[model samples]
Target chain A: MWLSRVDWEKIIKHLSILALVEADTARIESLARDLEKIVEMFNKIVELNIPEIVEPLYTTFFGEINLEEDVEWESMGIRELDPTGERLEDGYVKSPKTL
Target chain B: MLPPQCTQFSSISIKTLRERVREDSDFLFKYVEEVYRAIERYEQRLRAYITLRPISEVIDDIENLVKHGKLGPLGGALVAVKDNISTKGIRTTCGSKMLENYVPPYDATAVSRIKNSGGVVIGKTNMDEFAMGSTTENSAFYPTLNPWDYGRVPGGSSGGSAVAVAACEATVSLGSDTGGSIRLPAAYTGIVGLKPTYGLVSRYGLVAYGSSLDQIGPMGRCVEDVAIVLNVISGHDPRDSTSLRVNVENFEKYVVDYPLKRYRVVVLEEMVSEGIDEKVMKIFNSTLDVLAKRDVTVEFRKMPLLHYSLPTYYIIAMAEASSNLARFDGLRYGTRSEAEGKLWVDAYRKTRMTGFGEEVKRRILLGTYVLSEGLYEGYYLKAAKVRRLLHQEFTKLFREYDAALSPTSPTLPPRLGEAIVDPIKLYSLDINTVPINLAGLPAISVPGGFAEGLPVGIQIFGPPLSEGFLLNIAKLIESGRSG
Candidate 1:
């Protein structure tokens, strides 16, 4: 099963055994080599599974919206957080005359 | 007769006829041939200047002013530039080893303004290295001793400017304020310091420390002198994009036509709450009492945003400073290392190690850590979020009050070396003044009275674009001397 494949306790036990070893020169060097391999594996997981983190955030913030090309950074003022936890005025506004 | 009362030398009260004549071409050539000899006798001993304009150039300009019969507002008044400001063809050390030999190719906007107004560029005054310390003791070069005590601090960063004004070295001097640099020294030295609205004066020629927080302001013996200097420097400049677009009125107009009855001054309750020494608080209250006696209507109020000001200020300023100062990599400018057979990394590290002081290095390291990839979201970005909230709170407070008031410093000048080792205590010296800088509002520190014979200052913070109102309120304190 997918749940059984997770093996959280097995990973925790392996890390604990590594930590229990005395930090002698040999042990430290071996730990460093293992850490590098672990980091590479973690990077691969992140790269392959990026859609799981990014897609949800994009949909939530955009909500079926499109960006305006005419907008410029200099025209915007400070965007504040309102009570509803939304970015309140995007720092820039349409000129009053234009409105 | 003489030039208008405003332009006359004796009427101005700060300049000697001899000093004024340094800007007098007829006096330099036709009367006093050796002007540098005269300047040395009049202005040199105060240690008011770190660098000077050439006497040859001064003589030529003085000749022109006298020739065209051009009597500028400061026509003959001598002025000192704070060392942090770059002056074309002259070294602007900012009282540090880093810029000890760095001369600029063009004048700071303020310097150019003074020259155009026919004001003499007397010299650059001493300051804290990079305007980092409050006591001017942080100067890598030399500390500017207070003219009042000589044993005590002259206030810092802008200490040289404040001392120059208090000792009458220059009628008016320019000082830059990041976190109370102008006002604290002005208070300690018994001079007037004005930190104009953040964008009122251009920052084009200033060496950057914290671009969002630092502002150049005028320091003088009195309010009117500051007004005179501000008028010459306050107009919008195309060179500084941050400079305001609105027309700046003659600041003198505000002082002269002060409507004390129409305005309400709100004293900050937070300033008087705790840790404010008894004597200092007493003097500050007496100032309020005196204003009330004169029917000036003083109301005691508290600013909630100000409570979190000091910590928020440090996080933001240090983060910005760390980034701004990264340019001092011993490349292109400043002190370079002499380590032999050095790798590029070793040379870079060696140069920074030798050139910067402990406090500077600490801030830089903290800034680097906060800005690093992993920590930016937690520290730097969070601090900026807090800063935006503080600015909103300030805007709300200004909507109800004309200006907020507080003691310039929580305590009188601490004895030399008293809290020197404790960097946190030194950073807290800016407790009362930092919020104004964070909000980018204009504020002033006027001498309120004394605590144990040392001067104390009361601050007035005005809304953005309201320097005129801030100075006008400060005048009432300057005149009464009630405390």
Candidate 2:
């Protein structure tokens, strides 16, 4: 079934996704079409007749997760922590006014 | 004047390059120049690199290696790294506008390992934006064309790395495989790409796609060259928590003078039966004949769960991607929104909308949808259960067989602009390779043969951590092709 624009809008809002919904009509329509195909493809997973007894495999075959000791090491300064490489006046990165 | 041996890039293996460089230090510079000249000729059309280092930088690196007497196993070898793998001070765009100008402060663990082993960082190869698509068409900058046929895709998101090695632009390159990114491109470009057992190589610097499925591996013209690079990069790193604590094996040893062992190998009956291009099938059948001639028993086996791998992979991968990519909010080093007088939320919306490509946006939406409330159990959990079943099924098959073989991709490289139009068809191209990643097994795509002028690759996969064994099998086929 083709997703209507209203359905797409609902999905975007439901997911709290602003970027995909805010695109031009053509782009949004194309995305809807693509997502429809993907969703249809994903429908095959529901058809997979997996036995109920099998547990879900979340992780691959890495033997025993090793937890590191809580010893603190040399850390990146505030400047290094920032991806923009802009200097922080305090310890936090300045951003656009949210309020 | 360079020696004939040093001038030939594609024909000479990484093993030979290392030996020649160690014997004569001057050969390294001459070989690098030859690689650069090849790059200059091919880079215009192949578009293999996002960031090509200056010749002076490479020369300085070589000179330093020579002066310090620190030519490691991959000494003087020009290795093209996928742009996603961070290089200290090199722009690792990951084929995204967001990180277009983002120069990494530190080298990825794999990059550092290569440098320590004396491999020169030739350039950062192009890839799909954040490795979100099967075809390199999703790269934010531009799509990479297949070297074999300019009209066709190189098979990505490791397309550039594959093309660099295939077009003789780089001797060997590093690419990360997340659901056939390495192996599929390798198959298309007619090179050897190995996606080692997950955790065999650290993921410290690889931009996360499907974190569970991602692995940085080597791509080369031949299996031995792939093995050589694998040896240098494969090892445990404390930085990557998922890294396995195992001794790094001498993978190259398995390629040379290794006794050919008669082993039972299976071709998935389901994989070979349908959707494969006719010519690709003929090449695959011929590959089986080659293996049979090498004393390896080739048999057909059926696994019904294999059919469900594509959808299962998408669900798990996209779910993980949405979460992993959430860290890329404009606050960090990537491209931020330029809309003035906007709130942070608006900024994020604008930044992501502009920074990501169409395919990436689609995945992020799909990922968010799957992981959303009420949908998680139906989609994400069900796919996970099926994934478990696939892992169990592969484990059962491996007990009886040493390896499972199939055509790496079901079809030849899609003509440029053909695949992107139909997203599902594009995803289905990964049908043969994704199952191996879901099971987290070691798989290699060796240049099986050519079909209709495009290259066809046969995949050889074994149980987890069987990279050495898998490489040996691939080498056997590679050697047969040469001899």
Task: Identify the leading candidate in terms of lDDT.
Answer: 2
Per-residue accuracy of model 1 over B179-217 as CA lDDT, tens digit each: 899999998887789998877888889998888888898
Let me know the DockQ for model 1. Answer: 0.02
By summed lDDT, which 10 consecutive residues of candidate 1 chain B come out lowest? B1-10
TM-score of each: 0.76, 0.94
- Which regions of candidate 1 are displaced past 4 Å? A1-99, B1-47, B52-60, B257-261
Model 2 score (lDDT) = 0.84
Instruction: Judge the docking of candidate 2 as incorrect, acceptable, medium or high.
Output: acceptable
Model 2 pairs in collision: A83-B333
Q: Candidate 2: which stretches are off by over 4 Å?
A: A1-6, A16-22, A77-99, B1-11, B257-259, B340-342
Q: lDDT tens digits, residues B1-483, model 2?
A: 111222455457777887887687788788877888877777887798999999999999989988998887886788899999999878999999989888888899999999999889989999999987778988988889987789999998899999888888888999999899999999998889999998999999989999999999999888888888999898888888889999988888788534357789998899898788888998888877877787888888788887788899999999998888887767766887775545677777777777877778778888988887877877999999998888889889999989988999989999999987898888888989898889999999998888777888999999988888888888878776666
